[model samples]
Target chain A: MAEERTPLYRRLSRRHLFRLPLLHSRNGKRRWPIRSAGINFALGYGVLFLISATLFLSFIWWSSTNLLNDHVRAFIETDAQELRHRWGHGGAPALSEAINDRLEQNIDDDALYLLIDRHGRRMAGNLPGWPVAVKKMNHFYELTIRRYTFTTPAQFKAYTLPHGFKLIVGHDIRGRTLLSTVITRTLIWCAVMISLLAVGGALVVRDLFRRMVGSIARTASAVANGDLNHRIALTGSETDLVAETVNTMLDRINRLMEGVRQVSNAIAHDLRTPITRARNQLEEAFFSATSPDELRTAVDRAIGDLDHITGIFEALLRIAQIEAGARRSAFTTVNLNQLLSNMAELYEASAEDAGLSLALDVTPLPSLFGDERMLQQALANLLDNAIKFSPPNSMLTLSAHPVMAGTAPGSGAEKKPQGLEISVRDQGPGMNDADILRAHERFFRAESARNTPGSGLGLSLVQAVTSLHHGRLTLTQANPGLKVTLFLPLLPEAERTGRSTTPAETTP
Target chain B: MRILLVEDDPTVRSFVLKGLKEAGHNVDQADNGKDGLYLAIGEKYDIIILDRMLPGGIDGLNILETLRGQKNNTPVLLLSALSDVDDRVDGLRAGGDDYVTKPFAFSELLARVEALGRRGHNESAPETSLTVGDLTLDLLSREVRRDGQKIDLQPREFRLLEFLVRHAGQVVTRTMLLEKVWDYHFDPQTNVIDVHVSRLRQKVDKPFETAIIHTVRNAGYILRPTQD
Candidate 1:
């Protein structure tokens, strides 16, 4: 019912959409080009660059234009001051003469002067008559005036004289306007060049981004298509870091895939014997048994064989479940000292029955947060292995002690070990280096152990339990015996108190 | 013992039915959760064997919760194909008295079912001591005596004997002893339970004229008075 409630496209897109390339839709149609991250990044960079460039150019234009205007204003004020000074000394006649003198001395020929009587008649200046736009006194204005034969825009300031006469001092400002025009044109050209450069830079950046992403995508797609060997090639750039990380991840996946293949093969190979034996026994009982009792015995034996097969399956399932961390919810504070001693006591009788003496050496240990049963099972498996391989009248030692920070041998230098070190040693035929290396693999048995009775999943289960606790398991050849050690890290305070479920830090 | 078995798988259902019938239990069967819930509510049974996954609208946990909600105190044994520890915990947390994983040996199932059935009838006043033949165990003082002669036992052995004596004359599996006596639920690779039982036997029966603890082949161990 829930499946029917969801639309088909929604269901389909939820799983497969992410694996598809950004440029294409699920139906093989071309998607919006800007959806690509590289193009989007480039477009965003271009737009930002253009906006900032526009703001900078606008500021320059505004400031430069204001500077030019201030220069024009200063010239007008100084010229007007000279005229007013002359007016105070010699009245309108000297003021008029001074204006004429300023106009004559102006090299740029961009000066203008106009003097008017109260009756609105022009006295003397370059202008033909008094312009009506200059009505207020001591106020600056821009007005068009006829200077000789040409009309030009001028900045002017008007002043009232002693006999109600008016004087206007003005500057042409044509050169300033031309300079501003040149600046405006330059700014426009610069803007055009900046835009072109921005586009070019964006294209380069997009290309680089695409190259980096494309290789990774291609490698991923290849792997998805069942080509497990495909890998991203490093370009020796800063992106090589990402490339190396991806490559390392691929290697890990490849190894795990290999492990799965080996496990499946081993399961098939190992299970076939018991199954065949059970079938053969049942067939023999059905065809050749003389009495019901004989048939019953055969059937019972077959059932025993079948139970053995089920035991193997159960062990495998338990290992998988532990590795998947499904039992973490059952975690509680477990005292290692108590657990180890209990295990030793439980196995001491078994060890004695096999004519081997089990010695326990334990120090007072801090409690750890873990599934106590799983840890017990792991310890039991280790002790089982030790006793099984031990020779008659030999000593098997089970030891537990706290490993202080940075003290455990062969632990990573960067890892500060703060956990318990539990080891089981047996004076038996120690395994070679190769066997020790492959001991934890599923269903891996050494040549020496071929005749021994075991499912070959003991160490694998132990490894799984250790991993579940974020711990490490190591096997070493102790001269004439084998020593198996488990280093279980202590859960942090938060995890121990059940306030947080963060996984404990792993120690190598 | 009156038992109700709810299982969807025909093979497992018949196997359990035949086994229960042979064991002299009055059995009521249901092939689906709906019928199982109906029968469970309509009739009274001493023990209920419910499968975790059922085909009908109701599941085993739902029935268990409903039965508990109605203030029914019948012991229920949960059967499931999920053998994970979490699944077992979930079944027990949902008012199940015991849990048996699928593909289990009939002896184990029978042991657990009988244990649950016996637990239900044990609602009487608690006993300070248990007796199987001449052997008497004092619970409070943690003491054991045989026919007037005192026999000392380690703490673990005393607890083991206590579980066996409480369920005297009934089959108790190794797993049950491991869980109840030791408070641990794990399968040891070796015969550790057998060794411990042997040690307990050496102390409890080796010097005695009669042996009370007998191994029930392919099942587990049973504690009963020696037959004449």
Candidate 2:
């Protein structure tokens, strides 16, 4: 009961006005903080609304009382004017008669009229006498008068009548008193409505702000305690912008951590076999090799195994480098047709030696700005995969053609943006959708490819190269085999706008 | 030939030191960057094999840079675990004569060392034709003749023979042959260079009474006239 009388504003100020506790304690079992948060909200809003309502009511009170007083004054002035006109026509006796007549005529009304002589004797009117405090010369006044049964506030003006007579006229103004009473009652009701509205509004705003802050706090606490999977719930308010930024940052960190774990797993899983085989070969040669030639052969085989491991490391490093896009510095305006022709010439014989026919259909097109060597390597890896996978007498096709980038998703029509599509299709066992999806992943090899000689990083390298050149690589089933297509942008816009690109080797 | 090898790893140091010593080159070893820099600046050597990363404040690249800054032009082969092309470029840009990635075959290292040594010791005048006893190669006509008999070679075979003749008495590794002769940088799983060299030998050395391109034990091939 004592707390209820203390005023909500005082209670809130003494308690939780600015003591914003952002994070809850561990185990999250405490409920007082949330309850106090609600109390604080109500008290704060109640005080704010009460102050504004008081100010607005005070203004209305002053203006309404003022208007009533002005109306009373206007009536008094008109009555005085009529008395003066009577005196001008029929002398001082006539003016006195008119005053008496006016008093009698407004007897039922709250009108008050008084005729005073030079010595200040009251002749007639409901007022006991002209109050001495009221100024005698022409002046308007608000005076309290004693009536027969009651005292009421009155507004009047004193007028000097004909031949040393004074006429003071006023109205009772009981209606102004009633109006004040009603306004005061309205003010009280307004305060009550504000209290209710403050409570309702505070509940809504407090729920929104508190829930938002609470969600952020929970997510931060989870992340700080090393639970990286936790994320802030985004209901997409204006404040969700912050959640979006934080979530993306967390996602990036999570991806990097996952990448580190995957790379370590790959290293442990992939390099262990080669190292063990090399170590075993060395041990076997040390114990069992009877001849120097046999020992040399064993050592060479062991070295070969070690070399394979090193090659894997090299491939990993190259992929990392390509992903870094450091080789973009070596970009030049490369003739794609000429580059493909050279690649064809270099690997065509090797493909034939494997009893596979290599076909190339490269049409002359606009040159692209890219790392020439990286592109060649990408093409070479594709051809190498084709040769490795294709059966004898099967043909491999390499073709380059112009392509168009499609419109945004959900569009009914296709949009054509200038680009080039280069594909390497081989006539062999193609991969399924799942394999195609994971093909670009590092150290991911198909089951059939396990028997073949590869580090399983060829496609990953190709993907890296394509991304570095701002291109995309997609693997599709070529019916009989796999078809790998690379879509590349024509020229980097920076090169076109800034004129910064210079060919690494100029050939006219 | 005199060589200075600056390697921090004790095992790698002993391995390279033993190989170079067995190859008949005088070698001085430094186990740390400080000692390596001290020896490299104080003594003259036919070739310097330096690891890009080393213990102590003085690193291999810094030492090489300091030496080059002081007008030291000794051929330096940089060894690094950093195997990417950018790393290789960085090493060469820091004045390295050649860059070799770690976990390298000793044959590759020894061959590069011998080549750098010979390249350092050779006379400055450019030679259009090279002669080793009765074996002769004409650079202008792109011809190889032994005892006044002409030898025919393919384009790649001709480039391979030309490199051997240019570094006539020096060793050349299989990797060097692949890079210099074929202009290919990737390492193949198979020993393809051996097949190409064998083919070249059938035409260049088989018809002759004496073998010219001799494969060194655990090293590489040396294009020198064989002694009877």
Give the number of the best model, judged by DockQ.
1
Write one digit per residue (lDDT tens) for candidate 2, span A336-427.
Answer: 88878766755676676677888887655568888776787788788888888998999999988766556432232244446787999999
The sequence of per-residue lDDT tens digits that candidate 1 reaches over residues A1-508 is 1232123223333433464334776899987534445444544564565566667766877897688779989988987887788888998888778877877898888878889888978887877777778778888898877777777778888888877788888888777567667766765666556545645665677688888788999998999998889999998888789888888777767755765676678778998898999999999999999999999999999998998888888888888666655678788889778888888888998999899999888777778888898999999999999988988999999988777776653334355448888999999998999899989988888899999888889998988889888888899999889999998888677655544222334322
Instruction: Identify the leading candidate in terms of lDDT.
Output: 1
Best by TM-score: 1
Q: Model 2, B1-228: lDDT tens per residue?
A: 889999999999999999899989999999889999999999998889999999988889999999999999999999999887677878999999998888888888888887787888776888888887787888888887888999887666777888998778778987898677765566644345675777788899899888889897666788987675
TM-score for the first chain of model 2? Answer: 0.62
> Per-prediction TM-score of chain B?
0.98, 0.92
- Model 1, position A236: C-alpha lDDT score: 86
